[model samples]
Structures are given as structure tokens and as C-alpha cells.
Target: MPAKSVANAKGHSAGFMNFIREQGVVGLAVGLAIGTAAGDTVKQLVGAFIDPLVQLIVGSQAGLKAAEFTLKVGDREGVFAWGAFVSSLITLLAVAFVVYAIVHLMKLDKLDKSKDK
Candidate 1:
């Protein structure tokens, strides 16, 4: 009985694999490869361009310095690094804006095609 159950489980796993194969494995692989490359490109852009621009606007002190501020209340202490938080927030916003612009343009192109039809 245990052997039969194991065979059934193996058959189910094979069926799932076959289902994924039937769903255009080549296209999925190509899409994943392109996505990984695009991610790397964006990382470079953020590191080289966005980081510098943000540092300029937020001031060099905020960009290069990471100081811990301690808050004490009745012998309890909490430390915070405000500069690191600011830089991270700025980077997040810049990346989000770039993604939004790309998606918006793609949507506009789709709308334009529908209008033409």
C-alpha cells in the first residue's frame, strides 16, 4: 500500500511538471532572463546617477554620514540612524517613480493601439 501511494505521488509530480512544460517553458525562461538583466541595469543606474543626485539635494552630510542618536528615558536607551533612513527613502522613491513611468508609457502605447483600431 505504501509503495502504491509513493507511485501515485510521483505521477502527480510528473503531471505538474508536464503542465508547466506545456505552458511555453521557452518563453518563461526568456522572460526571466530579460527581467534579471533589466534589474541589474536599474541597480547600476540607481548607484551611479540616482544616488549622486539624491546626495546633492539632501546635502553631502546626510549622504556620507551615519551617526547614531541615543534617546534615554529612565535608564533605557534607543539609537537611531536618521541619515541612513533618509537615503533609503529617497532611493525607494526614485526607483518607484521610474517603474511607474515605464508602466504608464506602456499603458499609453496600448491605449494608442486600441484607438487606431
Candidate 2:
């Protein structure tokens, strides 16, 4: 390639990097990755630790991941599958709690403490 072309390419790359940094794209990407991992961790924690405690109390299946309710009327049977919704709610709660704990520990909410006064 010509020297001018090489220099132009280098300039473009540097400009792109500068734009990314200035726009906080790198921080946003890192935050997204960490949020995904934290969600996975919360799922594992709920499944392995919290679910059993819940099961023991409710006398139901672990995490309520499974439940069946059947009704019979006029020779017809109706089935309701509430388990999936319950499990999803549990997961949401777990993720929220984990996020809250992380935020508390990191003191991210304290950034405005001085402003409040």
C-alpha cells in the first residue's frame, strides 16, 4: 500500500478508538457483560441455595419450577400451568436482590451523597 494510504488507515483507527472512548461505549459494553454474568450468578444462587429453603417452607418442588393444577367440570378437565410464571418471578427477585447487594457493596449510590446535603 502507499504510505499515504497507510497513514490514513492509522488515523481512522485512532479516531474510531477516540470516538468509542469519548462516547463511553467501552464502559457500556463492560457493564452489559457484567450484568449478564451477574444474572447467571443470581440464577445459580437461587437454584442451588434459595430454592431449597423455599421448598422446605412451602412443601412444594424446588424453586416452584413445576406445579400442576387440574379442574374437572362437566366431564371436561382444565389444566393450569402456573409453575413457569412463578419460577420467572423468583428469578427476577433473585436478580434484583443480587443487583441491590452489589450496588450497596460498591457504594455506587453514594455518588450523590454530597449533593443531597
Best by TM-score: 1
Candidate 2 displacement at residue 110 in angstroms: 3.0
Which 10 residues in a row give candidate 2 its minimum summed lDDT? 108-117
lDDT of 1 by residue, 1-117 (tens): 699999999999999889888986876898799779877877787888887887677677454458568899998999888767767777788887766676686785353354245
Instruction: Name the TM-score of candidate 1.
Output: 0.63
lDDT per model, in order? Answer: 0.76, 0.79
TM-score of 2: 0.62
> Which pairs in model 2 have colliding backbones?
none
Strongest candidate by lDDT: 2
